[model samples]
Target: MRRFRARHNASARPGRSALTSEVGWFVVIGVASTVGQALLYWVMRHWSPPVLANLASLLVVTVLNTEANRRLTFRGSPVRAVQAHLAAGGLFVLAYVITSGAVLLFRHYRPTASPAAETLVLAPAFALVTVVRFIVLRLVVFRRRNR
Candidate 1:
């Protein structure tokens, strides 16, 4: 009985630890990506329309974020780099729609709002998208390589 219990506990540790590690790395990468995108958006907005700026910034950061997640967060995943980017492309479109819509809505309500205000509106949208991105990346994009 004691030996069986020890084996069971030991066997369970890897899955739990892998998940915890993935979550930790995902968050670290996500926050970095978020800051990067936000800064890019700020810089781009000075010349382009808000929606276009948002699109460009997201495009840049999405590529970077997917690669980071693949290398660090989902290390050992069997999915090839191209396939991961394909999946991440879909996620990028979703994020762009959500965030750009937030910007548009903010503008509609506050037409005189500054660039900072637009970014503020995007913050919650980014937060929501981050949670969804993690779930999809884990269950769909990476889908875990066989141990």
Candidate 2:
């Protein structure tokens, strides 16, 4: 027992839990994905209807997000991946509602807002949503209890 304790203590490093690593990766991925989503939305808006562009960007990013989180954060199995996709469906809708509402409200209040301004407003808005997404992904969808 003493030997085991020594070994465990020796291996322990402060502020470096598995969860900390996962969160670090999650933040990295979230930043990259947010930029990608915003850029995709901006470019697509020029060629497609606003609603369609939103859907396309949301769908693409959500799928990519799920896969990335499954591998990097959750380290999920095949079944867990399927479950993550299902959970992502609900998350995607919730995120869309949150982001789209922000956009709509911004437009209503400032009808002449530039596209750049809209993106600036959305960056922080989506950053807040990203926190919620991480919580749901970690606690609910990828919880070990489910598998």
Model 1: residues with Cα > 4 Å off, grouped in runs: 145-147
* Model 2 misplaced regions, further than 4 Å: 1-16, 48-50, 76-79, 145-147
61-118, model 2: which lDDT tens digit per residue?
Answer: 8899888989987774444678789998999998788877777788789888766666
Number of the predicted model whose TM-score against the real structure is largest: 1
lDDT: worst 10-residue window of model 1: 119-128
Would you list the C-alpha lDDT of every candidate in the order shown? 0.90, 0.78
lDDT string for model 1 (23-105, tens) is 99999988988888888888888888999999998899889999999999999988899999999888988999999999999
Poorest 10 consecutive residues of model 2 by lDDT?
10-19
- Candidate 1, residue 66: the lDDT equals 91
List the pairs of residues colliding in candidate 2. none
